[model samples]
Target: MVYTLEVPNTYGYVVLGAGVGSVICNIVLGGPVMKARKQLDVPLPNLYATPGVHKNADEFNRIQRSHQNYMEMLDSYIAMTLLGGLQHPIACAVGTVFYYIGAILYQKGYIDKSLDVDLARYKKGGALKWIGFFTSMYSTCALAYTMITAK
Candidate 1:
């Protein structure tokens, strides 16, 4: 008997999902940190930013919140992936793409949060929030089903 390493073809989507998702996540997190440094006028490393920094800056807080939410979602995605147990190649891959798209939208929408006078332009109608949430749910279901049915 010989054992060969062969990943299911459908897993390609899963791989792409992780790769692109990571890049998008980094952007979400990194952009805010940079903006925070500039806004707070904190020197290198002193960006040890506390919420107090946003006392008068609404936009800064929005950016900070977006980063925090991304971290939380990342944890959820990891758990779902683990529960999915590397099975259901097709479902896993498809779910991953949708998940990434949802996260991107979610981050964009949250970052856009503002109290600017031009409220109309700044307002995001919760599109990203719902998209990210539903997709995250769908992926969870897909993973659970696959794990439950696996032999």
Candidate 2:
């Protein structure tokens, strides 16, 4: 006997959420990375880091930091969606939306050069930055539990 997983129609909302999130991430990351590549004269592939001191190293760091901040949370969001999405699409959708919102918060702070102020200033908006993390984490945990104990 083969067991098949059921993907509910509601799951589409989660997909939508993921789509929105991806676009936000790509758009947010693109500007800095692209500008950094050009400003550093390092080509697109080498945008990850500034390599050595360039005239625009400080500016490049802003772009690089925003990209890094987005990626830092991306994996966890993807994992939670994949692991718990089928079991709880509504939760996943909500989680995904907030996760994207959280990323947006981080990106806004990064591009504004807010992080440069200091660690305390960087975390000034504590609730906003962490809501996504908490929402996804809780929903994913709940979904995982449901999956394991299903009758």
Q: Which pairs clash in the backbone of model 2?
A: none
What TM-scores do the predictions have? 0.59, 0.72
Highest-lDDT candidate: 2
Report the lDDT tens digits of candidate 2 across residue range 48-138.
5454646666666666766677777677777777556777788777767666656665555655654563442245342354665666677
Poorest stretch of ten by lDDT in candidate 1: 117-126
What value does the lDDT take at residue 54 in candidate 1? 42
**Residue 110 of model 1: what lDDT?**
61
Residue-pair clashes per candidate, as listed? 0, 0
The digit string of per-residue lDDT tens for model 1 on 1-151 reads 4323345666665655556665666685667668776876644654244456645355555555556655666766655643342455556555565555555555556666443524422254434344444554666687566556656
